[model samples]
Target: MSPQPVLLPRRHWLAGSGAALAAAALARTGPAAAAGETPAPGAAGATKPLPAYAAWKDPSSLIVHSSNTIETRRSAFGTGVITPFGQLYVRNNLPAPDASILAERDAWQISIEGVKNPRQLTLGELKRMGIETTAMVLQCSGNGRSYFPDKPGGTPWQVGAAGCVLWSGVPVRWVVDALGGVDPGMAYLTGTGGEKLPDGIDPKSVIVERSVPASAMADAMLAWEMNGVPIPLAHGGPLRLVVPGYTGVNSVKYVKRLAFTARESDARIMTHGYRLSPPGGKGDPSQPSVQEMSVKSWINGPGTDGTRLKAADVQIHGVAFGGMHAVAKVEVSLDAGKTWQLARLAGPDLGRFAWRQFVFAARLPAGQFTLASRATDAVGNVQPEQRMENAGGYNNTSWADHAVKVSVA
Candidate 1:
């Protein structure tokens, strides 16, 4: 995947650029077809394979939006709370660095500033300071953008652009303390990616640097591992910064510079990108940065592929999570949003930052039905009925748009 900016509308970006090839590939191989199941004869572009860089991923489990922006298939979720690395989504803001950098992962170094004793520390040294594991939702800011009526620019991702995964690394707090802590006035924790930049273009125009509230450091980490294994290059290997509960972008990949700053970074990505604005509005410095995700849930089973089911007991199940809070309960609706029933929360509670798998047992006769799930966090943040209209379609926690229709024979 090559580095590209998100400046054009979805149609223009997908149809006007080579990325169209990737989208075309997804169309020819629907979820079933990609999974090697029986498919209609002569599906368009069905013979194509995932980009060479991402060949390690299971094409059957993901929908390729572009070489750099692959998404998990809805059916590939498989009712599991911890998404396997093979099935996780990939959304890169810049092309990944050569994998050769990972030959000696422990030697990877990151510069830490705004501390009393600022210095560059290698991954090996940071790991020696302290290490912890955290389970959180890694969701793209535009996860449900396709549900937007205006169809914003960027990948028209669905719920599949998110997953709950475990991250292991040295807590940012530990690193700071080891380096004598941050300066008194630091207000933001900023991270800069290590991807190479275009030769003639100003670095600020394409660099991926984001700054989150300094308070987030309590839950942040400079992670070297994902799902218990050393992170893969496509998913930010060698080293990455993890900011739990925030949008995936905040967790900078190939992180090289991490600092406690007095102000947020002035990079274009921070000033003109990822901001929340009114529908059809242009991103500006006045807008808020897309950060913590909102509570969201979507039905994943009784397959939305319109498969006919025998009239009997059916298990309607899916996943739900409160962005930064623990989910208090999840309610399911069988007939769209008209009525709701409390669904059983299944599986061990991974953590507040992680999603919970929920299951609802329903008895049905031969017919059709719309299924939806609503989640409420411990703080009483209920999943909304409608997604707020926005310029970029960033955070869409709307239940109505994500509801699934099922055919029962």
Candidate 2:
């Protein structure tokens, strides 16, 4: 079942040598692993597969943590997580190659040089050169990182790292207008991932490389399906690089080369990890981090540990997003964060960049309780309980504050 790729609208070519000093020599060599060592065969180790749910809860007792439960429901705007499918959240940076040698290797190319005819193409020539889908929403520039207050260097991720899927691929401005447009002094576009820098880490580390610009690579994209299947190898199978609104570490995974520069590409995961710092301001380890993704929201399940209302009128779903916009509203606070109300949004099936599920209803006020939620987008923004300091903890977004503890006689 391998043969899909046909979508056009190309233009791209930018040549090299700018490298920004090899992106500071790959961020002073830093991703070779070895501190506790274990990630190698398809990496992201520690034991890998998770999300069965039976135990492991704590992240303020599930306001949303325990690695962000995959799915759950309670209603009246009170218990939600619902990510579903394989439980989402994979977030790899590197470590997912060898998918049966990429489905029996049809030679698997995809070269595309600066463009105008650099060519390499394969995966059935990008599915006869005409595939496109795009739903967007990747997240994970560290997702939440244990809520990072001070303990943040890399991947402590909590809000289940993030996900939205849909992808499909080929756009990226039709491979930069078929390789012949983006040159106007092009300013960065790098991207490489086929998995290789493991062994004790630091093959000149630098997160293994990923750069942006070229107007964010003409809105970037190369994905090869996901949610519509074909994108599994730990979540980067065959190809990946969706950058829409950024984050997810510049949306790169097993991508294996993209080039087109004028500067920025020495990789160390693109000049040292998913950066951010503007809104409330604070991050600037010498600038260069704002990779996108900000407005966020959460409220996974019967959290604050206090569920018992077998019935009596309850409904409080949750899930709001804002990496690319279009959430617009979703408030619900029971008290903990001090007054808020307005839930019920849910209508926009996957495009405003995905993620928008809200509900609200209450009629129990009998025993114990604690509930919360907050989200606001459509440009209004909102959603920020903390995050804004940045140095390493990368983009966060903040606004967590979820809580559950219900009991209503």
Candidate 2 per-residue lDDT, tens place, 204-265, comes to 47355666776765557787756455666666666777777677767777676777777776
Model 1 scores a C-alpha lDDT of 0.82
Clashing pairs in 1: none
Our model 1 lands, by Cα RMSD against the true structure, at: 10.4
lDDT of each: 0.82, 0.56
TM-score against native, each model: 0.89, 0.31
